[model samples]
Target: MGNNILITGAAGYIGGSVLANFISRTSGPIKAAQISAAVRSEEQAQKLSKLGVNVIQVDLVDETAVKEAVLRNEIDIVVHTASAIDGRIPSHLIKALGQRRKVSGEETYFIHSSITTLFSEEGGWPYGQVRDTDTVFEKEKEIGGPHPVRQTNILVTEQAKAHGVTSFNIVVPHVYGRGSGEWRKLSVSIPAYVRTSMAHKIVYKFDKDGHPPAAHISDLIELYALLVEKILQKERIPSGEEGYYFAMAHRTPWWAAMDRIAQSLHARGLVAESKPSIWPSDKMAADYLGFPVLYVRAMGTSSGDLVPVNAYRLGWKPKWDEEQFLASIDDEVQAVLELDTVKATIFDLLTSADK
Candidate 1:
């Protein structure tokens, strides 16, 4: 227990997976207490405690508390996975939905979680959105301008590194999987579309004309485990920067997949008739109107072509691709609907074994 590692956001998606990975790998007694989880809720603390992970309620933004936690725990490795979900649900939107629900809500236009897209401009033509990519995800993609998640990693990683804790930063792209993900980050749009199709008896809806990109839950966990293994094994890997990484998976045209989904839903008798349309009122057309938007995400999702594991040079590798990744989401979504217990199941799995 000499080389203690502190994992932040242990109750959340990526954090939960990271914990699961650590526990799954190291079977026998080893060097360093090796693992501790930090969270805010007492409930989360108790859950993690059950897993045998020392759980602490500390706010990392409070440099002093973070410093104290690291030192008191004798933590040598810190994996920070804390951040606010970017809620695009405006107050008005929520109110409208609530009112609609109260007033015999005839299931109207489906809702979609808003996303921070990236884009790039090249060959004098601009791509509409940007995302996790080789250089800044998109050439000039719409930047969420360095998210708090990335920032927190910096603080924790720097602190650990400064104290001579061999460190690596694992930046996870939108992650979707079982016992993981919120707001469709790792969700493969196809599965969601299929679900929608089944409910409406339609096969697909074309929010946009392109296939979306994604990262699977297991793949994301595997990447983190790889990073931790690489670090504990004392291997040198990139800390982003010169070797920046973005988690990506198989990309497919959105509408086509939606069509397939609708067809499946019809076969299942979940939906009635299908209407092929885009999710958003208008798809990428409006986004392309803005120069900044065009430069960021438009092309990243549509035309982005690169290996996500290149970020592995920075010490991260996900042994997953598009086809398997999409299938996993379908499984997760179906399980959640059928069992109606995604959150609880996630907690049990994460806390059952200490990492």
Candidate 2:
């Protein structure tokens, strides 16, 4: 029998890319009919439906609704990518999975999405490259966050395991590149910088230099597919917090990234100067751009070197490095300039053509 797959947050950037990649490329025991998308919008639903996907409208907060949806669909593998801040969704889904396992005598799996920001400290900066083996935790309450995604991951993973649900947690770094989905196209940080620069007509610089880690959306999705394939084959996956995988491709210095974007905008006559101007203060930067931009600015203030040793050991390779990522900036910026939509990216168009 084919494995039935259900992805929550089907309308989101990562989720959408995962859905498209999985449905378009998956083979050997996973069929397109076995794939279902739990989306929140009709527009997303219609678009996914056109792609021959099974779309189901889901309310992440509604425990009963989520449970009913899982059992009703007989989801063998549940990938949770939406709202990591909410702790109930994983528990509810695990409960439903337990019930299904009892009736059908089959095992279930849950892939929970997490962010690398959990590794950030208020003033801590690592001078050397850091790997997944370097990570250690104290307590969830001691951890600060814009959102407590890491803490929630720990809680949910524990609950899922306690309920006999095979859980895998994936921690992704600042994701770049275009995503092929119905709703959004461009990933965070870079596009935010581009849009902010377009709005202000110039690109600003930072005082210090820092290179944080990054991952291409396609590479991240590929890792997800590999892990899912292993799970379906009844292969052993590194479980628990220590065994969790960090999804990252390479590291790019903030100033270098700024230069690439500024060059693209300046060459296109979109910005006044390619040379960046130093921001006076965080508050002023936030005022000029937006709160989200501050997070990008923070990249320059600290070192976020995340090395994925586990990915290599598992034989998962990333196709795009910093150079390739930088080389594609012009295309991404040009897509936004020509299309007049933040969702438009050359990568998305290219990937969609492959389908």
Candidate 3:
């Protein structure tokens, strides 16, 4: 427990969840005092400080500041969850953390948060099975073609190995369920779909599209804790090509998810129809939802089969499944319904459609 752990995006969903988990861990290789979080604001710092996390206000874009934070703190373990909207992490920070290990002569471990959508982008889903090792970053002729996040992950993997720092890239997909963190209550993708459905009075899914892999926030957090323990124990944690860990419990089909949610709206009399339908066209779907066509396509066609082969090898199991997610649809959608602005938006959409 002499090692210090620095978590970036400590107030965000994934980072905050990791922070909360480590702070509350009763018995582990990490202690609450051994953990610190890089926050961006004094308000966020005050909130985390109350929870016993040593908070350092940081400008994540400033590479010099990021490097100094690691060197000054003598940080041994870094869990990076902060990223751009497209899931891009700073390569400079990766270099900085690696350099810190050399200066302090302390073996450092890094847990980089990536996404399983990389696999789905690789052209294997309903028909073809994809393991963590079957990463699509280097795959040719993908559905969405080349992706920015995939490129970043490949770069980070090579960089971490080049610097001799022990690192694991945890890839998660379609995270659902409520977060235990202090900031950001909901995930971005699914909630957008829910809001769109409420606004359009239609549940949309692509024809013949399969379900995507998904995990609850708590389960994903557990995987992070497990990986932390493995790294601290100096276990032969996989790295490089085999280092990717998929944090998925259930593969929820696109149609099934839309149907459940649409049915809930129908039951509440919010929509006249709850049955799932094929989106007319990529352009039309994009226009209706007010999102880019690429994003809409990514939401629909990017889903495929993803397996947690690496995570299972480490004896980590997910307690939540699709059944739990299905059971919570009422609460999940109702939470969206309760938003005052969301209520106003829905009313306007419904009234406009009547014209």
Candidate 4:
């Protein structure tokens, strides 16, 4: 009977790290129950068992199973870490808090996994599509905008307050670091094109030295450390009245991020480019995307406006470079591919020998 905390999506990219952080804390025994990643596979559960994390299955879609899990586990605190990037928060939220599950001697802390990509789409959102809920949410007077996750963040923030549950909306901006999640895929978002181009040319300056700030995984963990204190110990979370707090570090224009990545690749002479167009060179591409490439080209604009809550004033500053940061990611990709290649070669050789 541990001071049981239930963390959903425990094996995912973000959740895995979060779970690991909790397990390593200086505090005494704080037993955590993590939902396995197998989706529904017993074998995956067995694999998770080897990791020493209390593992189980509780799919949010199945209402009966969810309720039963909550009841059976006597879950004291729930860190609802699951999120669907495609704006599934609305459909899921009602069910998540709708049913009356016994949470005795138990408190719930709902933290949202909303990302910055929601703003990456076209039509300026909610402004164009019917489901584009931007207008409606702003009408409800929620701060922030058109991104679907923005609404999701707002919803969780509001619901946490409404239900007397402690909720905090941790809005992560282009999070990148050692972990394979955002650090790996982020190249596709901001740094990839320019970093890759560095191998060929030298035109990759960051729109006049734009600041492309990034949140290190360690800085993020530090933020969560205080957050855990605020919620569980001091019982000051979900400030019912105060809602979402953006969890991004100040990374500048997207171009700046790209520039940093480019610099690193250039150092290695992997690529080179001078005066490479940071924004979309063709209007057709911009029009097709419907979102402004200016967001990428301009420095200290869009992303800079998203500041975090002062409550987390750990005085944390970003120390990682987008260039080396991303270069390492490139290294990881190459390394993994190299491993796969070796495996393939070994298998082929073995097969030939058998033949």
Candidate 5:
């Protein structure tokens, strides 16, 4: 039998899409592998069970529940897309993987999904213009602050190494495109902007223009599949501190995107104007968009100068580029109008703690 792989946050956009991508494979190392999904609720579990994978509903914050889910499933590999800010969840899973290795006498792997925004100046990255192949771990350590994502990244790397489990961090940028997942098909940033514009009857933009890295959901999923395929084939690409893979397919021009979004919404009769106005205050944007006030500015502006070399080196070829993304603004608006069903809980923890 192939390895047993478990994916956390199976009801989320990225996790659900990753699960869909894996199961849709007809023939590959992935097809031979048994798949399991770790979700938060019975509703989510039932929804994912239809995909023909083992679905476990467990509280990720509870270490016992997380460890039990890991060990009971014999999960040799974990694709954690649940929480980038919470370090404890990954810590528990990595510790369980260490125990699983001792019992099964086989290798285990942890693939952590992290925020690429952490590399941006607003996100507290001190180093200018970094590549995925650079010493990101050390730099993050050197410039450590109250940034939860950075802390989580450091914890995942160090904890996985200490437990003797192979770990890879996928530095995820602003992900666009509708997801193939069963639930929460809409991504966070664009959908929120579209929804906020519809509610307020106007489009808004940040005062400062920024070009953050971005990827279409399809291209990002392809990168994940490539990494998993390489790992299942026993190809030692990179792991632990050296395993940072920046999944940046293109750069998102924030002002241009908002302008296009404004035009799209105006055409749809959802907004009052075809031009985006500068946000009067970050506080208003945060309040209306339901984003945490602390990170709202970073979310709206702050483009990291990140160059990705790792994923491409591992044979990842993303089909989407800047032109394609810019051309798809209408599609992004349409997706929010149609598929914005699930309330995004990814920021629930962050926002609650902020209060």
Candidate 6:
């Protein structure tokens, strides 16, 4: 099989950053391999094309188009970062990879990005303090709920196994720091909080405090690059049922972070007070933050007791700690002020279904 790789959602936050990481490598298997970026818009295609990678503008929901892109590009691996909830898109991509494997007579791989909140009590995970080495797939299937993330996770594992494609799920935590992508430089949770605070001229915090797992954007990208490097070198690592890699660097103290944000905004004359006010209700917070009401509480307050053993086993070292993340609140605010140009469409399906 050819060493060509395809990255879906190439214009999205995580996907675009992964693309940037792959291309910036000076000497590695990734540098020698052909890279293809699958974007959804002509504008995104044009902008990403300037980086000199093959940018394919194709709707991921279209199965035929997805298969064509994979086969034509001779893509051996697919880094799918499009949607954690939409199983259809990954289904198409995985099936396409299966077809490619048959044609090329070689193995194929799929790396799926998922949410860590699903493992918390608030997110319906009955078992507490789960490790990445645990049987995450079985437990998730046993607790089966209406959560789209969990459902999609099950879909990815099952479908990939059926297609004889090796799969790994990167259980993503609350990611922060400025991204190096061409589009959507800022992450979701913190930037939304900053925007909502500036809009109301006051910072709001949940009545209940949370300490969610988080990682710096750079560290998260490094984890991706490391996994890709391992795959390209044909190094045997965890895959299939035991491939849950938690991308967590530190724990984000929500109340404390909000307090710092309030103080920072107040010092800058952006807010009326230096102390954050308790959110009146989850509904108000959801409406203001533009997050799905059903998952907003979990997003803001659930801290999954996750023990990441897989990524670290692959020699993943994260430089950021809780202290560093707390100290960087000001930088997070500045990133929102400058690079919040791309409107997030990740929650579009959830919001529309709610309506």
TM-score of each: 0.61, 0.85, 0.84, 0.63, 0.98, 0.98
True lDDT of residue 13, candidate 1: 62
- Model 2: how far residue 328 lies from native, Å: 1.6
Q: Give residue 317's error in model 1 in angstroms.
A: 6.2
**CA RMSD per model (angstroms):** 14.0, 6.3, 5.7, 9.6, 1.0, 0.9
Decide which is better by TM-score, 2 or 4: 2
Give candidate 6's TM-score: 0.98
Cα-based lDDT for every prediction? 0.44, 0.71, 0.71, 0.44, 0.91, 0.91
Candidate 4 off by > 4 Å: 26-47, 84-106, 116-146, 180-213, 266-301, 313-355
Q: Write the per-residue lDDT of candidate 5 for residues 1-355, one digit (tens) a residue.
A: 2389998888899998999999999999999999999999888888888888999999889999888888888999999999998898999999999999988889999999999889999888878899989999999999888888999999999999999999999999999999998888999999999999999999999899888899999999999999999989999898898999999998999999999999999998989999999999998888888888899998889899899999999988899999999999999999998999899988887788666
Please list all clashing residue pairs in model 2, or write none if there are none: none
How many clashing residue pairs are found in candidate 4? 24
lDDT of candidate 5?
Answer: 0.91
Cα deviation of 255, candidate 5, in Å: 0.9
lDDT of 6 at 35: 91
Residues 133-250, candidate 3: write the lDDT tens digits. 6654344223333455565676776777788777778887778776666665556556667777778877777766667788888988888888888877778977766688888788
How big is the RMSD of model 4? 9.6
What lDDT would candidate 6 get against the real structure? 0.91
3 or 5, which is superior by TM-score? 5
Question: Residue-wise lDDT of candidate 4 within 34-64, one digit each (tens)?
Answer: 3222122455456456666667665555656
Q: Residue 286 of candidate 5: its Cα lDDT?
A: 87
Residue 351 in model 1: lDDT: 24
